[model samples]
Target: MHAIVIDDSSAMRMILKRIVTSLGFEATLAEHGRDALDKMDAADHRFDVALIDWIMPEMDGLEFIQAVRSDPRYDDVTLMMVSTESDQSKVVRALAAGAHEYLIKPFTPDAVAEKLELLGLLDPERVTAGV
Candidate 1:
């Protein structure tokens, strides 16, 4: 699977890339929502999944998610909020805004693996599932 990981922090992007690689997926980087949109617009490749940070400089994750979900070109991709927001209302809002999943900050590689497994992107028989 191919993934677009959007975040303002290069360190966070690198960490996410390593975790995604562990699950056998190639990860593309986007510094913010605008960059992500540009990449998607310019590429022949469509992302299978998008891991978006909730907070960003130009466009936040919610706005970004809305933009992508509203576009026919990205309709088939799974949108996930990989963020630090853990408040119940925030989670609900993200889900309402078209996020397929939520991953709070400080997540481990195993956490990522389990979430992917639950979504059937990873082999459930090969990994232990958890929230």
Candidate 2:
């Protein structure tokens, strides 16, 4: 499967890329929401999931999620907010905005894998095999 890592922090992007790559997803990196959208448009294949951060310069994760949800072209992509925004209201707002999952920052790879598994992007067999 394919995935996108959207974050302003280069370290976070690389960390997320590594996690998703280990999960067998070929990932596209983006510095912010607008960059993510542009990369998505330029990509040859549709991504299965997007790991987004809340605070960004051009566009935030919420805006990106809204944009993706409003467009039918990205209907198949699962939106996951991986941000430091752990407020209950924000979490609910993200869900209302079409985020399939909200994984707070400072999470383990296992947490990400669990969220991806819940999204059905991670194959059960691969998890069982410890891939």
Q: Which numbered prediction scores highest in lDDT against the true structure? A: 2
lDDT to native, each model = 0.88, 0.93
lDDT of candidate 1 at residue 4, scale 0 to 100? 91
Quote each prediction's TM-score: 0.93, 0.96
Cand. 1 TM to true fold: 0.93
Q: After superposition, how far is residue 57 of candidate 2 from its true place, in Å?
A: 0.4
Per-residue accuracy of model 2 over 1-131 as CA lDDT, tens digit each: 89999999999999999988988999899999999999999999999999999999999999999999999999999999999999999999999999999999899888888888888888876666553
Candidate 1: stretches off by over 4 Å: 125-131
Model 1, span 1-131: residue lDDT tens: 89999999999999999888777888899999988999888878888888999999899899999999899989888888999988989999999999999999989888888877777788775465322
> On a 0 to 1 TM-score scale, where does candidate 2 land against the true structure?
0.96
Alpha-carbon shift of residue 27 in model 2 (angstroms):
0.7
The number of clashing residue pairs in each candidate reads 0, 0
**Residue-level lDDT for 130 in candidate 1:** 27
